[model samples]
Target chain A: MAKPDLIIIGAGPAGMAAAATAANGGLKVHLLDDQPAAGGQVYRNITRNQDRLTHLGPEYTKGIPLADALDHPNITHVAGAAVWRIDDTPTVWYSLHGKSHAIHADHVLIATGAQERPVPFAGWTLPGVMPAGAAQILMKSSDLLPKDAVLAGSGPLLYLIAVQMIEAGQPPVAMVETQTPQMMMRAVRHLPRALLDRQQIFKGLAMLRKIRAARIPRYTAAHSFKAQIQDDLLDFEFTSKGETHHLKCALVLSHQGIIPATHLTRSAGIPHKWHKAQQCWHPDHDTEGRTARPGLWVAGDSAGILGADAARAQGVITANAIICAVRGLRPSIASHVNAHAINHRNRAQAIRAFLDAAYAVPPEINTPPDDTILCRCEEITAGTIRQAIHDGATELRHLKTATRIGMGPCQGRQCDLSLTHMLAAQTQRPIATVGMPRARSPVRPVSLGEIAALEQTD
Target chain B: MMTDSRFFRRENGTYDTVCLQIDGVQTHARATDTVAAALLAFGPAPTRTTGISQSPRTPFCMMGACFDCLVTIDGRPNQQACMITVQDGMCITHQAGFRPLEEPHDG
Candidate 1:
């Protein structure tokens, strides 16, 4: 196979849009996604699930065009390709069907996208507990739904899922939300800018209305959320409105918003900056999605926690910038800053500011109790991480060494936020100062056979 | 209308059901379903026990971020049930803690 001029690492909205934009500009584009289909986390399995999940609403259907655009002759969409590393040779290595393959492109785009923030709390690791978005993924991809699940967390997504379930005729048993009315009030300051994207605002409002219309029980200002198995179901407990309550249900779907999945970016040695509003580390990139590393770009949620629409627009902006570079043009977004996609991105980001303020991960969730397991892969407890911090283990590497955190296959994806916050809180420093862990290669676990196959290629 | 099952499979989905065995039980999952989703549709039950404390775990993240979904598929221990798509006749079993490190692997 001939090498492509541009290789996009994910097939999400960002990656797919970037591929179409670049391919239209005469670039041979290769787009790789880990899932069996396109549609990143947001529009996951869109091409197939679009008709099946009409209840998920029009926003879910918006991804259909993005998936369809991959048919452009210059764009090669490779699904089920788990990209684990981008070596300094600028070679993108991914494992497919148990074999490793490398693709060389003049330019690389990492659109690995976002993951639900792993909130550590008592009994979070219980078998019946899962990230609320995980249930959405299962529904989107596997045509399954969560029944009698309690939606717990702090994000618009929690409500969206509840509405989806309600539309399917099986609303969640209840919603125990951590975001208080006060948080929403604080977020009101960004209302003017948020109103610029009135459509999205209305969409969010519609979700809330649907949830209310369905009368799914909602508990606000909830904290101390925890769960355990009882009578073959999950018993969820939390303190809401200064009163304690316990609800038994078949499952507990937990979410605290999403953070960029920066494993591949961090593993590739790209610099990252911590977004205080999102309270996570995103790759250091410019307005046009250019990264610190020349010829490599990051767009979409991986660059930050921008929602799907902004991600699609950012993809266009990044692809245009790359096309300009390939053509030896100015490579500046200055001329088209007001273009349709650009304006859409700007508008979406405006609403993100309000969302960031309203649903910022609660401090209690960020800094879990000592008894909570912060690192699920290693089964390491928060107390162990705190003890490591107390022992002057300042950096992420030091904490890993002291408590085996981030040493598991997840490579700190699930534990990085919690560990950063704990180290910062214990040492009286900022989370950015405490820092995210230095992620290594094989961002997702690749079997030994996959790695060995790389050598056979040479 | 929704079914009463916790991990309920909805009707009129894109793909027809493909069968897979979870711990020797005959279970049906969508052809496009990942082994993780397969187990979840069959689960709320423990898919695999952890290697460290032997604590039972399920597919928590559904995305690859959480490794709790690791299960033995087709006699291959420690396959990420979320990463691989479900195939008809695939046999899946729980990874009791860690796999014996010397188990053979495929490409």
Candidate 2:
């Protein structure tokens, strides 16, 4: 296969935007993603020949504009391709359907987005517990609900999904959010920025308004303390405004916020920066998303959690920078796209900055009160990790190896960031300094029989 | 909505019979359901715990991707409760350390 001039690692908002902008800039672009669809987590598409329009709602359909870009002859969308390793010579190596493919490019854009932060608690292993993103995925892919659910955790996504459930005509019983007043106060610092685009702010506010209209109690300053399974229903205890309350529901949805997906970047030997406020490791980038390594750029949530609008602008900005690098000077169109791009970025940044402050990791996440367990896989507890740390397990890698923290299934996608945040905060080390574990091929574990069958094919 | 019925398996065991041990407590679990489903059939909603600060965590994503449902089953640690089937005389324990000793090592 002919090597494209540029390779984009993700097919999400940033990758799609980057591909479109790059192709429009006259560069040969190849876009790849592990999923069959291009839209990332936020705009996930239904795969079973059904209309994603009905399954995922309108915001997802907005991605249709970029999806149309796939029709461009210069852009080759390689769906189901998982980029496992970036060689020492910068050759991109990926595996798909048990086969390997390699691409050599002058430039690469890492747009692999973030994953959800796992907040482990007792009874998390019960049949009904699931990440808010998973619920959103199921809703998008299958048009199904968890059937009588209680949603908890901190972040706008939480309320958004709750409202989505209501709109889907399967409103959850209650929404238990852990957004503290202090966090809201921190968020006020960006009020001027948030106020810039009243439409964006109103969109978020509208969801809240709808939740209230549905009489679904929005419980702020609340935490899902503990849960017990009772007759196939989850019974939960939560504290709100210093009062403890109990409720019963069939499912629980939760997440703190998103972290940059560092697996590909880390595997490629790209350096990272730890944003304490975001409590996640982000790729170090210039204003245009150029990483420390030449010919490599990162944009969107892959760099950090700047919402979709910021992601689009950042993608464009990064493509412009790549064009400039290729031509050895700024393109004439740079002047044309610069002003609008800057405006979009500034507007997106305002809301993102507020969101960063508003959704800062709560105190509970760092130091889950002693009774909470940290590793549910091995029944590992917070006390145990602390004891191990006290026993001189200094680094995250050491702690992980010593305590089997990230070794569980799910490939540490869930607890890795939360663990990094806690360890970074405790040890006073930057989260960037902490090493992110690499994602191996067959990213999702397959059975031995499946592996044997693949070997036979080869 | 058509679910992949292949993912759902039916067992002939009685749903009401069988005593299981969840972290040293003699709990009742059904052989016909998944460990997670059986646990949910009981009183405690969360079957596992967090590694940092030992906060109580329940399975939020039951599809087996969240890693929140890790538990020590029989002698294995970090086993996903949602993906594993329930059986009689299963000894399930709570995971408690950053690296639980029972973790399956591919290293």
Q: Please tell me which predicted candidate would have the highest lDDT against the true structure.
A: 1
TM-score of chain A of each: 0.97, 0.90
- Candidate that scores best on DockQ: 1
DockQ of each: 0.61, 0.12
Off by over 4 Å in 1: A455-458, B1-5, B13-15, B105-107
What is candidate 2's lDDT per residue for A1-458, written digit by digit as tens? 66687889887788888899889888888888876677776666523313434524456666777677766888988986767666554567665655666677889999988777767776655556667777676555333455677888888788778777877677878888888889899889788878987777888888889889999877788864677777556788888988898888767776777677777776666777767678777778877888888788898888888887788788888888787777677555664666688688778777777887887777777667555656554555677677777788878778878888767656666666657666766777766766555555444444344344432110
The worst-scoring run of ten residues by lDDT in candidate 2 chain B lies at B1-10
Which CAPRI quality tier does the interface of model 2 achieve? incorrect
lDDT of 1 by residue, A208-291 (tens): 998888887899899998888777777899999999999988889998999999989998989999998888899999888888
Model 1 residue A128 CA deviation in Å: 1.1
What's the CA error at residue A50 for candidate 1, in Å?
3.0
**lDDT for each residue of candidate 1 in B1-107, tens digit (9 for 90 to 100):** 12234687777824577888988889788788888888777756688888899998888888888888888889988789898888999999988988886766553
Candidate 2 segments exceeding 4 Å error: A46-57, A331-336, A376-379, A424-458, B1-107
Q: Indicate the residue-level lDDT of A307 in model 1.
A: 85
